[model samples]
Target: MAPNKVDIRPGVSVLAVLRHLNYKPWFALAEFVDNAVQSYARHQEALRAHHGDEFKLVVNIDIDTAAPARISIRDNAAGIALEDFGRAFRPAAIPPDRSGLAEFGMGMKSAACWFAPQWSVRTSAFGEDVARTVRFEIENIVNDEIEELDIHEELEDVNHHYTEIILEDIFQVPVGRTVGKLKEHLTDIYRVFIREGTLELRFGGDALTPQEPPVLTAPYFREKDQPARLWRKDVSFDFGDGLSVHGFAALRETANTAKAGFSLFRRGRVIEGSGDEGYRPAAIFGSSNSFRYQRLFGELHLDGFEVSHTKDGFRWDENEQPFLELLREHLDSEELPLLKQAEGYRARPARAQLANTATQAVNNTARAMEDNLPSALPDIADAPPVDAPDEELPHAGTLARKEFNIRFRDKDWHISIELTEDPAESQWLVFSDVAASIERPRRLDIRVSMIHPFMVRFAQTDSEDVEALLRVAAALALAEVIARESGVRHAGTIRRNVNDIVRSALSEA
Candidate 1:
């Protein structure tokens, strides 16, 4: 049979070809940064033999949105040869094998097209004073149709020894929105490359600087002769004394939250943090024993996989998912016993303790007295002290006394407070823990019931004085609870729940 021939389309612009890529908005920047890093590495290797540290390969991004209206990426690299600049412009083309860091020659065209309709690149290398340039505009060549981009002639520049990709007529993209988004998405995506000092990213004057690796590293428990100890905690329980399970949990606190979540890292770099495919569903929650108490962090070392040319990212192909799942299952086995122990601990009743119950009672009385006094009322002359007889005052109401006993280690205390009501008075109930050990002291504890207070306060059948008294008492009790609880520092979750409870009561009334 004769050799088969197929007609090929001509004049397909690079933009038309790049549009076919599954280029999401977030991935576009990664592609561009990858190309920049490749250029930097090329520059570094060429100069490494010369043994001069004059100018390390770097990528500088200038974000100027004024009338000049441009963004530029300049790199001092073994730029494209004067001839290759034009050839580089076409779609589906790969760079020569000698290009160290750049692979998949399509990244340049695809990444540039995603950002703007018009973009150009200039390059220079090896004692060449003038660099070659290639310019292509997607909109002009595509004629507003979604088609491949065609490359124009590669022009040589005069006196410029480096490459600068200038993006113009940027399709009216929002700079603020773009920069803020790029900051978050690209930060972790490029973390490892940045850390290795193999790449640099600058946005105007702001830069994402890299940090040194940790001084201490944690073991995955699978390693032999562990270099340093990875901290682990064991938890067990005696629930009804019959059943028990043993589990353990460990954490290297620093690395876990360094990226804002319990990232499952492999080979000292992040794999799970950047890609969802690398994480097992079970790993979504930390170790079962640590759901509420701690976050589980995993670090694995895999040095053999091929990382993408961007240098900031990589993949393990089909092996990643199963690998993560196995790790998660292992962590669960180690955490079950601890989770059981924690569950038992949380099931127990919570207790509060305080010294000087008598003083607290007296303070409560004094606070009540100050609160009840009206601003217009003049001070009574030589008023009877607290010890004075309970003589009948002009006020017509029944006083309600509520008393409670709170117990803690080694002491006993009593607390009583008076509530005045013009209608049905408040009731009191008292219970004593006579068997309470000296190791457990019962102190006076009082809590005003909010549900009943609001119910009676707003009753339609109540007299004006009765309603006013109930309202005052409810408001006073609420004020006291707020003052005491707010003064102490504690978890906001409980406080928020309490506030919702009070609000519900008030709404019902």
Candidate 2:
């Protein structure tokens, strides 16, 4: 008997246009995995019985990079049934059921065409006696306006169920760094299924596994003596009209800026937020550098949300704001105040400590300071009378800039210091500050002048002398800000005295 034809005429030309669809490599690969998972779910019982009691759905993706590169993905699931073959191959044809991860029938076709000009799908459905293979030569089909494709079939065991898709002469094959990152994102996207024991996804000969971090369990920073409590909390909220969320929000036992933020899921797959690109809403996380952003992480399952065709993001339709408002209300409740805890908790970083040589250097400096303190300190450190008027700061042509942050007395401090070579500015140290409140971090901006007469005479040619002078200037600027914060009036007195005394008595010129 002659096999039935697959009509792919008018819509077949659309394959050329799909290649330009903005698709990240990881998201594009996920399309095949979604189809495999959906198929496994649709015929779980019968397929499980045929395989074994310990049967688990597995999907493997291989990327061949040598010479003529090719990509292949194979899955152990109920393949395209004979009845559904037409709709499956047709462009933009909706599936019979639109509730699963493969709801948008465009995933396979779009992704396949986006990846290569030629591809083939070979599959044997769960109960079907005949196995079939369908191949697409997109360029020939489009250029020649070909309307029909041959379906090659062969008799097969009725219980065998699997699908294999091979993309030949790959257009954009993943290579080098992309291979590792591709595995990471693919693992993250299917982490929920991996957790639930529903799917075992593999890529490049390795099974992808989830790497869940440990949650924090410590007393709040303010309540040091109190007993420790785990910082993981379950959150559930409804924004009315079928929009809802359920998940757990937590702080990592150790802070990791890159791995933090919410992973929004739908239909047992990540719709938004995977890998380092977690969904961090500014309303809740503030700046990306904020402690909340470095510590807070979660897995949120969204029940009543519409996902994009690519399944990479949700379609909010002006509902995102209200959804966030409710999410914040539920996650940041007064009783459990998650944002406060994330900000209040401080963990020391794990970067390399000072070496023995550095410690010895510090000890030598301290000893020298101890020996010189009595005579030098009394003359320079004595509290000077408040005489200099508070004056406006002068601007400069900045030559270098750097910044560092310090956590002290349970407050965040940002130090933005700069070096300036502008000869028009006579002052050695110029500073400005923004005071910290409950609402904002404290900021101190300092510019040390390198073209002052005293600096030019004493430290212009020696890098070591220039370093010492910069340290002194920065220390003096910091002391001024701290003294003003401590309610000392005319905080500029010490700087004014030092500037004048150095220029008059110590100036080599």
Candidate 3:
């Protein structure tokens, strides 16, 4: 048993692995930027000792789409040493410095191979007079014909301390449209780093700026003077082992478009969210499309948490469960009430819009009629006499007024409008339910015929204005019924004339 020695054989093809890397171009490019930033952070003391405190780290990325596409990323950080070249180019190598952003050493090699078939790196370590250069070709590695890494050493400027990666024969290049998207991705991922001025990243000739989270207002109770408002709360939670989360939650006054949810960030980079249902907690937001949850959004930073190899999401383990539970508790106890208050804030504008539209429609119709009318028409004072009032007028006791409850702006109101489902030959019918009334205060039954042509057409479209118009029409019908029951003279004639005018105006609109 002691004599048996088994040798391990590497059977994986480098090009085959590269083909299955599954990296978005933008995320792949971020690898190099991460490396550059980490390099600066790890060697900050050494860099300051060599140069002054004024020494700055700058990363520049240039992309060219002409002919065989090419991309180059250059950084003014402490460059790689001659001794570190072997580990630097090796795939799946663990980094020596793990405190910084670059933990796994696969970022550079994986990103380069994923971006292009041919890539090269040139670096001059700080205080070193010679620079080392290495070139990697996918075709050569795939064939397994290359045993030794070819590295060249050349004399460089005494003050030069930087690393530059150039990708040639690029399989695909980011162009006009994707360039902006790439910039946005990079900025969002490194917003904290950029905002703190720890790193300067330039894409093409433009410098990248941090994307600030939307400002959240504090939620306030709706009062007569200040009816609507938004509110924010600071949230912090600790899950032991130096792992903690801190951020702010905001309950907004209006519906959120895309900026609603907890944006989870780790190590100054956004891992998830700043979107709808980015982090789901049923107790806090209920479910997706819940009105209360839609108005809430925030950003939370995870101080110490394990991330996936791709760095796109967090590793949900036993330790993460407590953090999520704490977050849920905070939302339920503190944020839920603010969300309820925000409901009133959201409704005020919708109600105002409906009222304004109805008022404008009536005014427009009246103006059009006035402009078309002949100026020579006889006045109401000279009009023919009307018929005598009906002797058998309906009594007020014959009509019943029922109370209907409506919820608006987080408050309920009672009104005497009865709803019915019975089909009528006409579009709508408003009548007093005296026979059906047994209570002291009777309510008029305003029956809307769903089978009528007007109701059928409006129901199919489901427009907001259609609903508003229906409410207005029901109110007018109720007014007419009340006047008739009270025995108001000429009430029947007035109701007929108003109905005809409304019908004509609606046709014109």
- The Cα error of candidate 2 at residue 237, in Å, is 0.9
Q: What number of backbone clashes does candidate 3 have, counting pairs of residues 3 or more apart or in separate chains?
A: 11
For 1-509, candidate 1 gives per-residue lDDT tens digits of 11121111244554655655555444665555666566556556566555466545566767568764666777655666545543465555567763343466666777777667778876675556654555666766677543333233343443334667887765445377766665655555566666666556675656666432232233332332455443454433222323222333444233222232333332333433442222324434444233223234333434445555333445556655654454445544653322222211111011121112223433454355344533322332122211211112222232334454422222332334433333332331111112223574322232222123443333212223233433344344334433433443432334344445644544231
lDDT of 2 by residue, 31-146 (tens): 99999999999889887787777788999999999857899999989999877887888888888798888887799999998898899999999888888999999889889877
| Candidates 1 and 2 compared by lDDT, better number | 2
Top candidate (TM-score): 2
After superposition, the stretches of candidate 2 with alpha carbons farther than 4 Å from their true spots are 1-4, 351-473, 477-509
Q: How far in Å is the alpha carbon of 303 misplaced in model 1?
A: 5.9
Which of 2 and 3 is ahead in TM-score? 2
**Model 2 poorest 10 in a row by lDDT:** 350-359
Candidate 1: minimum summed lDDT over ten consecutive residues — where? 346-355
lDDT of each: 0.44, 0.78, 0.61
* Model 3: ten consecutive residues of lowest lDDT: 1-10
| RMSD from true fold, candidate 3 | 14.9
On lDDT, the stronger of 1 and 3 is 3
